[model samples]
Structures are given as structure tokens and as C-alpha cells.
Target: MFPKAHQYVNIHAHRLAISQDEWVLTNLFAGDDFPGANETAYYSTGLHPWHIKDADSEQLIKKVELAAENLKVLAIGETGLDKLIQTPLDLQLQVFGAQVEIAERRGLAVIIHAVRSYNELIEFAKVHQPAAAMIIHGFNGSFQIAEDLMKAGYYLSFGHRLLISDKLKDVVTHIPAEKIFLETDESEHGIRELYKVVSELRNISLESLKVMIGENVKQVLRIR
Candidate 1:
């Protein structure tokens, strides 16, 4: 947990920017360089599907394992299936499963990047039944798909897209508060703005929404 109180928490972000002590969980891909340590932020690192084609499979897995052991690294991914990418589904599945195993071993939650592959991920979740929390970041899927994942005990994270997509707005209103999260996810939007949008959609005050999401983050990441 951060030292500051009542700060808007960005559950996932890419580029790290200076903030007024707001909590942020920055994402780092497995085959790339780690972020600088000047900022106070939590991190999640894994092999993204877009880089899987050129990444060294063995070394990538080792890197994820090593990163997961870090106290500052609270989650295991930004990793999952992406059918739109050129990486073979088989290889994606293999790498995703390996990261899930590592997350399970280290007791860290996973931040998944799923695109056009919800069914595949759901099936994988059923088979693996991971003990660690699994959050699907940047989720903009159908309500049925969201329901399916929620039923399977996965959390759904909404990003800046929620502000523009009516479908996503509808989906967000119905998700249980306990199973929902909000993120910036490489978007330029402020986390506070995203929270306001979600608060209005859910018919709750921003403070209440932030408290709920903060608790969810604490529970999922096992933060004290």
C-alpha cells in the first residue's frame, strides 16, 4: 500500500509520469528494459504477445520468473492471448500458461491482456484454476463475455475506452463493484477523470467508487 491516503490508483499504466503521490502500477514487458527507479510505483512485467515472435522463449520465461520475485512487482502480466497479433495461438497459450504458473508460485495477481480470445482464456482459466487473482486489463468485451469471466472468478479492468464506448459503459454499470477496476492503460486520461466517469455510470460517488476499487486492488495484490 502507498503512504498517501485517498489517491486515485492506476491499476495498469505503461509510461510512468510524475504524480502528486498517486499510486500507479506500471507495466513492463518481459524482453524489454525495466523502468527507472526514480518514481514511486508498483509494477507488473511479463511477455506481451506482440513481442513473442522475436523474443527468446526460454529467456523470457526466466525473466518473468525473476521479476515476479521482486517486492515492488505486484502482478505477473500484461500477458495473454491476442488473436489479432501474428504470434501463433499455440505459442501464446504456452507462454501465458508459463507466466500463470509463475504467478501462482509467487502468489502474485496477474494482469492479462486479452484481445479477441476470451473463450480461449476462459477455458485456460478453468483448466488451470489459478489460486492467484487474475485481472483482464483493458477489457471491452461483450456483457456475456464479461459475465463468463466474472463467473469464473476473474476481475475485469476498464480503461479510457469506457468514456467513449456505449457498449463498455453499459457493461461497466452492471459489473459487481467487487469484481471491477479502472485503469489508464497507456491512455492520456487522468485516473481521477476515469474514476469520475465510472462513478457516474455506476450511480455512486467518486469516493465510494475509489474506496471499492482500492479495496479490490489491495485484496487482489495482497497489499497490507
Candidate 2:
């Protein structure tokens, strides 16, 4: 079974520093991708905290607007707060807010790149109450934090690192199975490995979890 493709809402460029060849080959999102041309792009964009530094602010905003407008840029970004970096947190928040506004304006979802700034991010979410769902991508927070985010009605996407987390397991156990999702996030591991961990954690058969996650992924990303 080749990738046994499921409907993916979006695939961001954060994990894709090069041409999007893998998803291009997988046809996991949309129509056929030309062998060498820009891959049949996923419905999302992955913008990490670091990538925005060199990006021209006005141009970046315009690009975000264009993506939200013309292309099927269904998700604003993997943008959020990070504490350890030299990039100004205020500037980051400005960029993050601008993207969020763009998504809000266009009624698109957001793939958040939150780190130690959960409270700040949550506060922003609370105030704006954006219609587009917010998914905490690459989550690695404590169980309490996860619970808090879940209670606040946000979604979470799990990658390889989260799979190895005992704390995340504890947190994940409490998460509504509907909100749980497994992803590779550009890691070498296949979705099957992620599905394996999820199946065990949810105490369901692999096939069952596969069906559930497939449905969940589609629902979150608004995929058909």
C-alpha cells in the first residue's frame, strides 16, 4: 500500500526547504503533480519562527494575502511565539498576528508554531476568536498545557517527537479522540509508524485508528 493516502488539509513549506517532491509523489492533497514542476501543493503553508527573520516584512504580508486570496492557501501558517530565539518576540507576534488576521479575513485555518508562548497565543486566540480552527502543530508541551488547550477547543497535530513523549501520552489520553491526529511533519518516519503509536494509545486496532485519523484529518483541514 503506497502511502495509503488520506485526505490532508495542507502541507506547509517549513518541512519542505526544497521542492515539495514527496507529497508531490504521494498525491495526498489534490490533483496530479507534474514530475518536476511545483508539486500539486497541499492546502497549507508551514512557516516556522526562524524563516520569517530574513523575509521582507511587506513582501511577506503581501505574499500571505495573495496566498489567502488566489492560491488555495487554506492555512495562514505555522506561526506563533517562541522564547529561546534571538528574533524579537514582539516582532514575531506582529508577524503572527498579521497572518492570523489574513486567515481570519479569508476564513482559513491556521497551523500554529507555538513554543513556550502558549498562554500568550491562547490569549490572542481568545480575544480574536478567529473562525478558522487553530492547530497547535508539532506540540511538545506538558500534559496540563495540552489539557488547557484542548479545553479551550483547539486542535493538536502530533509528529515524531510527540510520539516519544510520556507526558504527551498522558495528555493525549485525555484528548478527545476526534481532536487527535498523527503526522510525520517532514520526519523520515512513515505515517504508519505514527498510526501505530496512535492505535496503541487509543486502544484500537491499527485499521480502526487509521479510519478515525483519516476522518479527523479531513474534518480539521476541511478536506473532502
Candidate 3:
């Protein structure tokens, strides 16, 4: 899957980019408008835990399942547990489990949005043993947590937090190229900048990083 690519692979991002050189997997929440299909643009759709306060959970879950039928929909979420929010943990788990089932059944990856519940997520993974790759998007957690997830066969995506957190930088350097991904994930920074930072941290060429992440994308999304 490493096609000697010069393009950046943004595994997860909220805003769409017009760049022809980059491959952006844009995230569409359950109610968001699904953009018309394009060659460079792909998407992941699910109900986010934060926005589920007033949502009709079953309806949105059905929407995610329907979206999974689209070829361009490569992943199931931007969905996972978050303890900081007021949403009940039980409800979050229920909604998250439903999305995971969709991804697993469809053979797609699951992009996760975890906040202060990494352990819970790990436990969930152990119990469910989901076949779909679980990627922790916008990961700023400790190296131990990163290692634990990686050991459990989960991938970690770095975003704005990598720019500010020295600890996260160390984690990035230690993370295997195949298990690492860089994302914008609602950040203002360009994906290229994150790539540059990571390449420098890992002491590898920018092209190498591009190819590494491109392959990681292929592996996680089961792209040919």
C-alpha cells in the first residue's frame, strides 16, 4: 500500500480540505451532511458520545449502520467512552458497543475518541476482542497507556496535543511506524506540519513517514 506516495494521509479530520495531494478521511457525525463522493475524500460516520445528550440513540445507530454500506465510509467512529462529560457511562458504552458491532461486522476500522477512560476502553477491547482495528484518535495519554493499547493491537493517532506535549512526543518516537497515525482532528495545524514534527522526532524522512502512515491507513481500513 506504500505507493512511493508523496501525499499525506490524514486518518481523521473534522474539516474537509481541497488539496489534491492529500488523502483526508473526513469525519461526519450521525446528523451531519454527507458530502458527495469524491476521489480524494473518504469518510467515517458515527454518533459521538458528546453530542448524544438529546439524540435518538437507536435512530443514530441505524444511521451509522446505513453509512457503513457506503464504499467511501471506511470507518465506524470518532466514537468511544468519555468520563469528563455528563453522558452516563452506561449509555456511552451502549452506544459505543453498537458502533463497534457495525464496524466489526462490516470489516472496517473504528476511530475512537477517548477522554479519561483509556482503561475502560482497554477492558472493553479485552472483553469484546473486536476484529476491527481500534484507533485512538487525538491521543495525548501517557506512554504506559500508549504501550498498553499498542500491545492490545490498537493504533494511536496524534494531533495538536503532540505539538505541545513533550510526553506525547516521546510516545510518538517510541511508537512503531505501522501503529502510528497523524491527524488534524479539529486542530488548526496542517497535517503536513504534524508529519514534519513526527518525522523529525522519529529521525526519518518526510516521505518515509508519508509512506508509513499510508500503509497504516491501508491496514486499518482494509484498503487494497
Q: Best candidate, TM-score-wise?
A: 3
Assess each prediction's global lDDT (C-alpha) against the native. Answer: 0.85, 0.62, 0.86
Candidate 3: tens digits of C-alpha lDDT, residues 29-90:
98887655554467889999987865488888888898888777889888999999999999
Q: Which tens-of-lDDT digit does each residue in 1-224 have in candidate 1? A: 55244677888898663586467888998976764444356789998887786448779889889877677788888889999988889999999998988989988999999989999989988998989899999998989999999988899999999989999999999988899988898888888888888889889987788788878887798642
Model 1: what TM-score? 0.93
Error of 1 at 14 (Å): 0.5
Q: Which residue pairs come into collision in candidate 1?
A: none
Ranking by lDDT: 3, 1, 2
TM-score on alpha carbons, each prediction: 0.93, 0.78, 0.94
Candidate 1: segments with Cα more than 4 A from true spot: 2-5, 35-39
Please tell me which predicted candidate would have the highest lDDT against the true structure.
3
- Model 2 RMSD, rounded to 1 decimal: 5.6
- Candidate 1 clashes: the total is 0
Give candidate 2's error at residue 193 in angstroms. 0.5
Q: Which segments of candidate 2 are over 4 A away from where they belong?
A: 1-39
| lDDT of model 3 at position 50 | 88
Q: Candidate 3: list runs displaced more than 4 Å.
A: 1-4, 36-40
